[model samples]
Target: MKNFKNKVAAITGAGSGMGRELAIQLAEQGCHLALSDVNESGLAETVRIVKNRNNSVIITNQKLDVADRSAVFQWASQAAKDHGKVNLIFNNAGIAFGSTIEGFEEKDFKRVIDINFWGVVHGTQAFLPYLKTSGEGHVINTSSVFGIIAVPGTSAYNASKFAVRGFTETLRQELDVMKCGVSATSVHPGGIQTAIAKSSQINESLKSLGLDPSHAKDKMAAQFITTPKKAASMILKGVRKNSRRVLIGPDAGFADLMQRIFPGAYQVLVGKLLLRRMR
Candidate 1:
């Protein structure tokens, strides 16, 4: 756990953004990679990048949907078999949705939960046995700043990420109590320059809020304070240090502090921010 060299890492959502950056950075550290993503081309690109960086490092790419429990288990088994052993599982696959409970359909909410919450659960559960057997293992689950503080139009996303935070935190404690070498870290990232917002499923709530979709998108992008590479670096540092929680970006740190100092008032602040965006 202290070093990544020659260690095998299995990453979900390894096609783009932080996941892809994580793979690249880990490759630079001489870590072998097993990467998965629903987007075949993106996964291929990541694979190419990693292999280019370290031709000697083992690299495997699979088209995967983390929401599928059976598929995740099968992939984890196959990955372990292919690589001989696995040391880290980065349960980083997630989706973004923008809608209030009143505006979003039940199915939409369920979809977010399946990929964002259950996906983490599935990844951790599926790979845990292999990780435990590896003797020195780690689990890094990607949450979000929204996980710590609720937002107006992201109820489903908030719910899913909060569940992830709770799940990973409890898993860390359990691992500690069991005296296992495997550890878990929950990551909360603020806006980074990623395609997540562009790819997000936004409900008609934007229309009701009197916000133009394009303008809203621009505003979201403008809020980004970090790059995926930087986020990846911070995340890897956290993993190396066995940090219980990793907060990425200054905004994320600020949000965590604000929540800690004004838990109840934070909701009001978010509401005001939403109202401002509506105008």
Candidate 2:
């Protein structure tokens, strides 16, 4: 927990963005890695980058869909087998979706929940036993600033992220009560520069709210000031400190503050800002 040297970590969504940066940084610190992602090519690239930098670090990868419970358990078992013991599981794999609650499609909403919420559940349950056995462990679940404060045109995404925040917090409390060596941190990243926006599923329902679906990705990306490297560094620092919650960027910090100060009234302010942006 103090350092990653010689410790083994299993990361979901290790192919790109903060996930890839985490793999790179952990390798630099001499941690062995078990990486998984649905994108085979991206997963390969991550492995390649890590190997090129640290030949001594052992790296194993799988083409994994974190939404699949069985597959996640299998990967967890394999990671434990390959690395001998697992100290950390970063449930970082998630997808983005944009839709108005009234206009949302069931299928689209289900997809978002399955990937963003259920994926974290699967990863945490799958890897937790191994972590307990390791005697020192941490669960890092990626939420979002929206988890702290909701906005329009992202009902499904907000639901999933809020679910992650609640789930991780309860898990952390249980781990503490049990006096387990394992702990959990809920991460709220405020639009770190990532392909999530470009790759997001923006529903036509957003147009019902007078928001241009086509411009949604660009608008979201424009808010991403923190780099992936910076986000990863913050996350690792949180892990080392055993922090209960990790806010990645200044925007996340601001959102948390606003929510704390205004609570219910912040929703109105957010709505006004979003309406101004749409104009």
Q: Write the per-residue lDDT of candidate 2 for residues 1-279, one digit (tens) a residue.
A: 899999999999999999999999999999999999999999999999999989999999999999899999999999999999999999999998888898878998998999999999999999999999999999999999989999988889999999999999999999999988999999999979999999998878788778788998898788789999999999999999999999989999999999999999999998889667764
Clashing pairs in 2: none
Candidate 1 lDDT, 56-106, residue by residue in tens: 999988999988999999999999999999999999998888776778899
Tell me the spans in candidate 1 whose CA falls farther than 4 Å from its real position.
274-279
lDDT (Cα, 0-100) at 131 in candidate 2: 98
Candidate lDDT (C-alpha), each: 0.91, 0.94
Predicted model with the maximum lDDT:
2
- Off by more than 4 A, model 2: none
